[model samples]
Target: MTMPFRLTVLSLAVAATLAGCNRDKADETTPPPAASAGTGAVVTPADAAAPMAFESKTAFAEVSLTLPVAIKAQPDLHARLYAAAVRDLREFSEGAQADRTEAGGDEGLGAYDKSIEITPGAETGKLFSLVRTDSEYTGGAHPNSSFAAILWDKALKREVAAADLFTRTGDLSALDIALCAAINAEKKKRDPQAETVSLTGSDMWKCPRAALVPFVLAQGTRPGKAGGLVFLIGPYLVGPYVEGSYEVTVPQSAFRSLLAPAYADEFAGEPKPEHAGA
Candidate 1:
């Protein structure tokens, strides 16, 4: 069955080392193409300027990673995020290979696939946000997709965890309540029969806590101001996998008081119309 795979941010130095090791392995496994006669430059068949930072194909698996131009513009952010994605892809590829070997090629397994894309989000003041969506199928009954949020601090030139934006690192209860309400609203819209449950409820349909969910900053009509937060809730969190994922948005006014003093002003105005309750 499909399952969630969490992605964590890694240090730039560590990512660089891991990338170097992977490069060495690739060189050993695949030989380079011949160079042009007149220019004396290597001519690779694949487009060198493609957005894909990494790609691999084998009998067991096919993996690829793509980063947006906005992300690539920030060298430090790009290196750390790319490194983490590459590491996950390698782990998945290795595990698939091992499983294939154990099965002895009798199970009629198809080649597993994984694709990760980093899309640019809103840029509010000193904080810029990006969303990473991962889709994979490793011999599962069906494919699974998950999301992660990357908050980059332009002033500090480093990545910021969502928890760091608040005073209390534990849980933002106010934000949690707002998220629950927003999700329930979306549920009712999708399925009129779907019951709206509270966080205190014990049923599987109960709303998930905001602190545990991934979120990206939403862009508003006003320039350099955040519309609000768009919490990314995966399947099975509130409903069955067949229902798919949910993107519930909580407006800035909903939990503005919960934000840390430093980030209070960063969020203002209403979320763009298109992403109001998405």
Candidate 2:
């Protein structure tokens, strides 16, 4: 009885193997179906998520948001960033359309464009710092550009604002002074004829409050550590629109004591040479 059962199993296995081989042979000879005329192009996940432009007789608008490859490697972070970009683009496009309608321009309004690019700052074991620059034009005399910082916690998989990394008792006044000095120096270098503005002045030309400005972590000589902070001062913040934007970097040594205990170790050394004055 046992021998008969074993023989039956062997016969079934051989039959299955022969059937699989026949299918493979048939598949080899069978030509794959051609893609539909309009569907021939392949779209990757990133390509599918690319920002779309809005064009109409009344208005034309477009947005471009770019992220670093490293940031895109994280699924949750990538999705959040992409969703936010899409939302912003959508809002801007809608607003442009509405403005055109309100203006009642038969020839259509001017085009609106917004471009955002995110670059890597410092990528450590526990944190990833990024800098985002935004250039936008919305019926203004000239396009305006600004900067923003995004700090992501690897363990928590979420964004951590720069303000949260400091202690409650941290003395940011010193950092402010440093930033003010740097701005004045850069201003002097750019236009020797132009006079440097006072930090105590209550005008647009006065030095901007460091805490209020957007800042990103600067890369340090030591691997896996932040060298310092780079304050992003947009036009009209610290000076006239003609002065444009400024990237002032303050070394970590200047703000070492101001950092919270948990974040102190994340910073070390000085700003890389390439990022020093620029």
Q: List the residue pairs that clash in candidate 2.
A: none
Per-candidate TM-scores read 0.79, 0.76
Model 2, 1-278: lDDT tens per residue? 01255877787777677768797564443335543436776544443453222222224577777777777555566666767766776787788777766877526456788777878876766778778788888865899888888888877777887777788885689888888888888898899876677769966578877778888788788888888887888888777888888888888888788888878888888788966753
RMSD of each: 10.3, 11.1
Q: Write the per-residue lDDT of candidate 1 for residues 60-112, one digit (tens) a residue.
A: 99999988888755666766777788999999899889888897872776898
lDDT of each: 0.79, 0.74
Q: Evaluated with lDDT, which candidate comes out highest?
A: 1
Q: Worst lDDT window (10 residues) for model 2?
A: 50-59
